[model samples]
Structures are given as C-alpha cells and as structure tokens.
Target: MSESETTSLEAVDIVRILELLPHRYPFLLVDRIRDIDSDRSCIGIKNVTFNEPQFTGHFPTRPIFPGVLLLEGMAQTAGAICVLASLAKSKKPEQVYFMTIDKAKFRKPVIPGDTVEFHMTKLNQRRNMWWYRGEAKVDGAVVAEAELAAMLVLE
Candidate 1:
C-alpha cells in the first residue's frame, strides 16, 4: 500500500475512552475500541452480561439487551473516534452530541454472554459534524445496523 493508503491501527481502552467521553457506568456502552483508522472507521466492543441494570426490568422472564442501547453503542463508537481525531489536531471539544439516527434496524436480540462489535465507518464529515454508518455484530453476524450523526461542540 502507498503511504497515503497506509492506515495505522490503534486501540483505546476504557480509561482513555472515559477521558474522551462523558458517559459513565450504566451509560458507557463501549468497553473498548480497536482498529481505529483516524476518524474514518473503528470497531467498538461491548460485552453483554446478565447483570446489567436494564435486564432487571427490560424483560424479567427472558432477558434481552435493549435495542436502543445498541444504537447508543454505535453512536458512542463513532463519537469517540471523532474526539480522538480532533485531539490529534490539538482541538478539544467540550461535548459530542448525537444528532440523528437513520436507517436503524434490529436484526436479532442480543443476550448475555454475547460479545458485540460495533463497526463504524464514516459516511460524511463537515466542519464539526460527522455522519457514520454502524453495524453491531455478534459472531460476525450483524445484529443491528444504523446510520448515526454527531456534532462536536466547542467551548
């Protein structure tokens, strides 16, 4: 691959994600992020467990990971990379806001013990706004997909 075509793969653990994002426990959906190619793409990992708070009432009899959280995971995954990319340029944003979700679809129910990978690819970017297409996959099969948009707010 040529120099411009070569992309460095980076991984961000929970600690750094915490610094880049405002989400906390019970809200921080992404456990780790990997294969980060600047702000263009990345894969965020979420390990579903039976002990998560949502399972307590989402469905007492047959617990299932809520689909809305899956979409949030995708947005968080994309938002993280955008912040990371901005930091590389010495620009820090105060907050990253989820702007829109489109073409969202849930293909399967995610349950405990499932390790989900939210694969996100940038679709468009302008100024401080970014649009991404994300796919949440388990065992390499897509469980959910959506197109998400986010805007970075500066101080």
Candidate 2:
C-alpha cells in the first residue's frame, strides 16, 4: 500500500522470508523476497554463489545450475505467496503442502553470481487447494516456469 511496496521492487531479508517459509540453510533455495501481493503474486530473488554445496558436484569444475533447483526456487517463491495469503503466523510451512507441478520448462542455465528472480501469480483456488503459475528469470531471460498446485493443510 505504501509507495515503496507499490513500486514492486522492495527487498525482503532472509530472516523475513524464513519466517514465512520452512526452508533453511542448505535447502532454502530462495535468498530473499523482492515483492509480494498476499495471495495475488510474489517475486523472490536468489543470488547464486560459488559457496553453495551443489556447486561441488553439480559439475565438479564447471557448475551449471540444475534445472530442477531452478524449478524448486520458483515453487518455493510461490509457496511464500501462499503462506502470506494464508499462513503468515502459523509457526510452520507444512500447514500448506505442495501437491503437484505441471507444464514445467527450462530455457536457460543459471550460474554462479547470477541473481535469479522468480515471479509467481495465483491462477485459482479450490477449497483448501491453491493453484499458481510461475516463471524464473535471470537478467530478464526466462530460466524456468511451471504450473503448480498446493493444498493448505490445517492442524
């Protein structure tokens, strides 16, 4: 609602994103959130660094960002949107569970020092289930995308 948030490029620190998502340390794919619109949409940013564990064996010497990891980043970014829309303060991320992924594609290889941005938008909802479509990019070039589905599980 504020001018900075309305501008659509605000940055979210890792701690803030961790508060909404269950991922952490080595497994947390997203580095920060740049923007979020509750349930409507979310943009997450990740800075790939040479220190990542995957770089060791993903190639041993010439590391190419794995396509599945890119897809995972996109899904996690979308998951952050879902959490903000439905579970910002529930104490955990399993309250909403991912169910399916469809129509996924990879267009480029993401490498170290690249900052990837994942943009996700809500497509629809069915009862406790939510559907989203997303794209991941680096330097405005699409690196990955998918039609994803998730279910909000309650305790």
Runs in model 2 lying further than 4 Å from the true structure: 1-11, 88-94
Off by more than 4 A, model 1: 1-9
CA-lDDT, candidates in order: 0.92, 0.78
TM-score list, all predictions: 0.94, 0.85
* lDDT for model 1: 0.92
Q: Write the per-residue lDDT of candidate 2 for residues 93-120, one digit (tens) a residue.
A: 4565668899999988889999999888
Worst lDDT window (10 residues) for model 1?
Answer: 1-10
Global lDDT of model 2: 0.78
| Candidate 1 Cα deviation (angstroms), residue 99 | 0.4
Error of 2 at 99 (Å): 1.2
142 Cα displacement, candidate 2 (Å): 0.5
Candidate 2, poorest ten consecutive residues by summed lDDT: 1-10
Best of the candidates, TM-score:
1
Measured by lDDT, the strongest candidate is 1
